[model samples]
Target: MSAELRDRFFALSTGGAPADEVARYLAEVDAVDTEPAATLDGLGISWHPTVRFKAVRFVDAERIDADVRELFARPSQEAPYLAAVFVDPRELSFRTFENIVPLDRLLADTPLDLDLTRRAELAEGAYSFSLRLPAAARGHLERLDALNLYVPPLNSGSRGGERFIFHSAQLAEALTKAVAKALPQPLRDGFSHVNPVFRCNRFEPGDANFHRHRDTPYYDAERHHVSRYTLLLYLTGGSATPALDLTGGVALAEIEPFTCVIFDQRYEHEGAPYDDGRKVFLRTELIFTFTESEVTHDPEIGALFGKACYWTGESVFAPELARHADAYYNQVAAAHWSALTPGADREPFVHKQFRGVHFVANGYDFWFAKSDKLSLAECAAITLLDYFNCKLGDTSFRALCQSEVIEADEADAAAWIPGFLQDKRGDSAVPPIDKSLLFPEPEEANNECCPFHSWAAFDATRSEDVIELYTQAQTFAKAHILPAPIVMLGEDVLLDPDKFVIRGNSIHVLGKESLTPVNFAACWNAGGLPGNYIDIAATVDTAHFLVPPIFFTESDDCYHLRFDFFRNSWMVKHQQVTIPVPMVQDGVCDDGDPYPWRYAVDEVSLFTDNASDRGKADLWWVDNPAVEDEMRDVFD
Candidate 1:
C-alpha cells in the first residue's frame, strides 16, 4: 500500500462509518490472523468483513446512465473513479428495501422546467432531463433507499453528518445483478466489483460548497491497481441547485434530488456553492480493476491494498510541478480540441506519427487513447494541463512536430527535448570527470583549499589609473579581510572592467563590471572568502602584458601543489611564499587539466637591479617577515 492509501484506509477503517459497519470491518481485521485479504469468489470480489448494507438509495437514472456509457467509452487513466450511490433504501419487505420517494412522487413535490434563462450553460446539461426509472427498477430503488447510509466528513472544519448501515443480503444480490447488466459486455468482463465507499451531502444555504478538484490520485512510478470508477447517486431536491463543471466544458446544472452525475475522477471539476434551500445527496464508487487479467480465479487471502497512487488535484498550488505539466501538455495534446467538440465544423486534423505522443510531467506519463479523438481541453482538464496554463503560462495546445518525439510503443511516447540526457551522449558530449580523483580528500582541509586565479601586476599605460585601481582593490580587501582579494591589472578579456561581487556565503569575486548584482546573502552564508588573491607588479617578463596569466588551483577544493612554469617552483597558497626551482619542471602540472602551466621564458634571474625591478618583483611570492621559518622548509 502507498503511504497515501494507507493513511486514507486507516482513516476510513477507524472512523467515518456506522458503528456497526466499523465493528464489522474491525472484526474482519481481527479475523485475519495472517496478511490482509479480499473476499474473492465467482459471485464477486469484496473486502473481507465487508459492511453488508447497500449505501445508495435513489439515483438519477438518466444522469447515471449517461455517466456509465461515457466511462466505458474512455481509457482507464481518464476515469480513475466513476461512482453512483443509492439513497434511501428503507426496508419495504423481509427480502428488500424501497426508496422513500418514487419518481412520480418526487416530480409532484419538485417540478423542473428548462427555462432558457435558467438553462445550464455548461458543456453537458445542468439538470438531467432523462430521469426515466423503469417500473421494474422502482422496488430496487426503494430497497436501495432503505439501505443504512453513511456520510463521511465533507470538510475538515464542518461537522454536520451521520453514518449508518443495515446489511441486507438480498439487496446486495439484486444491486450487483443490476450493476452487471448495466455495463457493456467488454466493461463487464474487465470490471472486478463495486464496494461501498459512500458519502452523503446536505446542501443548505450556507453548507453546499466544494472547491474544484480532481478525485482519484494519479499514478506515476507505482504499478498499483486502484478503483477505475466513481459512482454517485443524488437523492434529494430543493429550489437552489449547485453549478457543476463537466469534462467537455463548463456547464450549469441543477442539483435537484435524484440527479447523479458520474464522470471520470481525473476530470478537474468544481461544485458551486448553494444557498436557497436544503438538499441531500448520496455518492459511491464503482471500483474496477485496470485490466481484465488482474481478476484472479483464486479467492484466497492476500494483500488488502494494492500498489499506491498519488493524486495531483492539489498540485496546481505547486509552481514547479505545474510548470513542467504545462510544457508536457503543450508538447503532446494541445492540437486535438476541434475533433472533440460536438458540432465543430472543422475536419479531424490527423497527424500520422504524432497520435501517441505522451506528456511526461511530475512522474506521470499522460498519453492519449488510441482513438486520438479527444480534445486537448478535455485531456487538459482531466490531467494537470489547466493548472499549468492557469498558473505557469498558456500552453498553445498544438500537436508537436513528428521529428521532435519518438513513439515508445502502443501506449507510450517520449518527446525528444534537446539537452535532455545530453550528459549520456557519447562523442559529442563533454567527457565525464572523476570528481573523487579531482579533489583532495575532506580530511586534508589545508590541501583542500587552493587559489583559483593567480596574482597579476597592476598594469596600465596611465600609471596613475593603475595606481588608483590598485588602491581601490587594497581598500576593499582591507574592509572585507580574509580571502584577501587578488588584484589583476592586465587586460585579461575574462575581466571586463573590475568590480566586486559575492558568489557564495562570504565568498566575493572582483569580476567583470557587466555581471549582475552579487547575492551578498549567499556569500555571507558560505562563511569567509573562497581563496586568497594578491596583486603583484608583473608575474611574467612581458614589458606590457596584454593579459595577466592567472595562477589558480587545478581544482576548486584541492590545495594540492602545482608547478608554476612562469615562476618555476612548487606553488600552493598557504601563507604565500616564493621559492625558485630549476626551469626543468616547466609544464610539470597534470596534462589532463584543461588549464595547463605554460612557460613564458625560461632561465630568468630573480636578482633585481635596484628600484627599476622594484614594482615588477612583487609578482614573486615573498617570505613573511614575521615568520622566520623558510616557506620552502614547511612543504618539506
Candidate 2:
C-alpha cells in the first residue's frame, strides 16, 4: 500500500463507520485474496497487479485487492459478471489453471459415451461433438465490449509501461457468471469456487496467428493433453486470420465478444491473427475429460425430462429441428413451384447438388419416428438454405441458390466436422467441392423461359452460383437417363422416376397428401398418365424426390407431434422425443451423454390412381428387384 493513501484507507477501516459494514467490506477484500498474491510468484505464475488504476507491487496487495473489490461491487446496467479488470490485452492466461488440472483423474473418471452408437452411427457421431446453448447464454455471448489485459514495451524513446482497464465490465461479468453457472460439475470446482489450473490469456489486437495445431494443456510437443471438449470464451476485441480452417470441422470465425467458440481439440485448427487495432479479446479455455463410467444413465433417472421430436406449434422462440426440412422444401419448390405459382424460377435447386437429396426431412421422423442418423454437413446445409428461403422468398432465394457461394465447402466445414480434416485449396482456406456427385440428367428443366446456359457447363457451374444448380441437376437426371438407386432389404424408393416433372423438371405423386392446400408438392397431374412425372431430384440428394409418409406418433417423450416440410427454420422444427433411448450407457462408456436412438424406414411405395377392383391399394410399387435382394443381404 502506498504510504500517501495507505493511511486514508486504513483510517476508513478503523473508523468504525458501522460494525456490519466493516465486516462486509473486509469479506469482500478477502474474496479476491491469496489468488492474486500467489500469482506474483512461488509457482511461476505470470500476472500483473493494479491498485486504483495504478500498477502495484505485491507488498501493496491489500490496497490493490480492496480497490478491485470496490470496483466490482458497483452495480452496472449490464450483466455484473461482465464487469472485470481487463489487462491491456485480452487473453485467459493464469498459471494455476494450466499446471494443476487433474488430467489423469479426470480422464479416468470420464468415459467415452456410446449413446450415439445406439442413436445410429452418423447421428451418434455428429451429436457426440455437438453442444447447444440456452437462448440467454447465446445472446450474452454474441454481444460486445468486455474487459481484457495488456502489457508490452514502450515505443522507441518512450518509457516502458503496464496498464489494464474495464473494456466492458458489464458484458464481461455476465459472461463470467454465466460460464461459472453453466459449467458441468467437474468444471465448477476447477473454476468458480476454487481452481487448480488457472491459465488465462489477454487477447489484444496484435497477437500472432496460430499454426494449425491442437491446443495442448501442457507445453509438450506431443500435445496429448488437448482436451476432448473445450470452450474459447471471448471477452473483448476483434480477431481473424488463422480463421479456423479445420477440415470437415465447424468453421469458426475469429474472437467475437460474448461468444464462446466451443470445440474439440482433437481436430486440426488455427485462430486468425489479431489484425484489428486496439481491440481486446479476453479469452479463456476450459477443457475436461470424461469416460463412460463417471456419469450413470437410467430411463427416467431424474425427473422425467420432456423432449419434443416435432414442434407442433409456432412461436418467436426457435424450435428444435431436423437438418433437411427447409432444404427439402426448397428442392421441392425449385422444380414444382411454377406449377403452383406460375413463372417461378427454380434453377438454383438442381444445380447445388445438396448433400442429401432424398433423405426425409426431420419433421417426418421427428413426429412419426425418432432418428438421429443425420450428418452435420447435411444439417448445416439445410440451415443456410432454410434461412435464405424464409428471408428472401422465392425470387431472392432462387437468386442466392444460383449466385456463386463466396466460399468453398471445406472453408466452412468447421461447424460440421472435427478440425482434424480441413484441407484448403491454393492460398484460400476454402476448397472447392468436387462436382462429381452433383449433376442433373440430360433433359434438365424444360421451362422455356429458364436460361439454358449450356450442357456440361463446368467452369461456371464449378462456382455453383444459384443458376448452376439447374445445370448440375440436369447432369444428374434428364428425361433420357437416370442414376441407379440404393436398394436395401424390405424397402425400395424410386431413384429417378422415368417421368419426374411434367413441364419443367418435377415429379408427380397421386393422393391429396402431396397436393395439400399449401401446395408444397406438385401432385395434381394435369395429364393423367401414370408414367408422366417431374424430374425434380438433385443427384446429391436423390431422396429429394419423396417427402416422408407423414405420421403422428409418440415422439419418445410422448408429446403431441407435427411435421410439415415447408415450415423450415433453424431449430424451429426440432422436438425431442424421450422414448426408451437404448444407448450403451453403463457397462463401459462415458455415461454423461444423452440417450441415442435407432430407427427403421421401409415399405415405401408411390400412390397411384386405380379403381377399387384393379388394386387393393391405389399405389405403384418401385420394383427394384435389387432392393429386395439388398435388404435381404443387409438384415438377413
TM-scores for all candidates: the values are 0.25, 0.22
- Compare the candidates by lDDT and give the number of the best one: 1
* Model 2: per-residue Cα lDDT over 199-272, one tens digit each: 23433455454434444321111221213334444444464554445545655455444444544444445555
lDDT of 1 at 349: 14
Whole-model alpha-carbon lDDT for candidate 2: 0.26
How much is the lDDT of residue 453 in candidate 1?
30
Worst 10 contiguous positions by lDDT, candidate 2: 575-584
Clashing residue pairs in all predictions, respectively, total 56, 124
Q: In candidate 2, which residue ranges exceed 4 Å CA deviation?
A: 1-206, 218-226, 236-242, 247-257, 274-636
Taking the tens digit of each residue's C-alpha lDDT, what string does model 1 give over 407-497?
Answer: 2232222222212322222211111122112112111112222222321321121233222333332332222222212211121101111
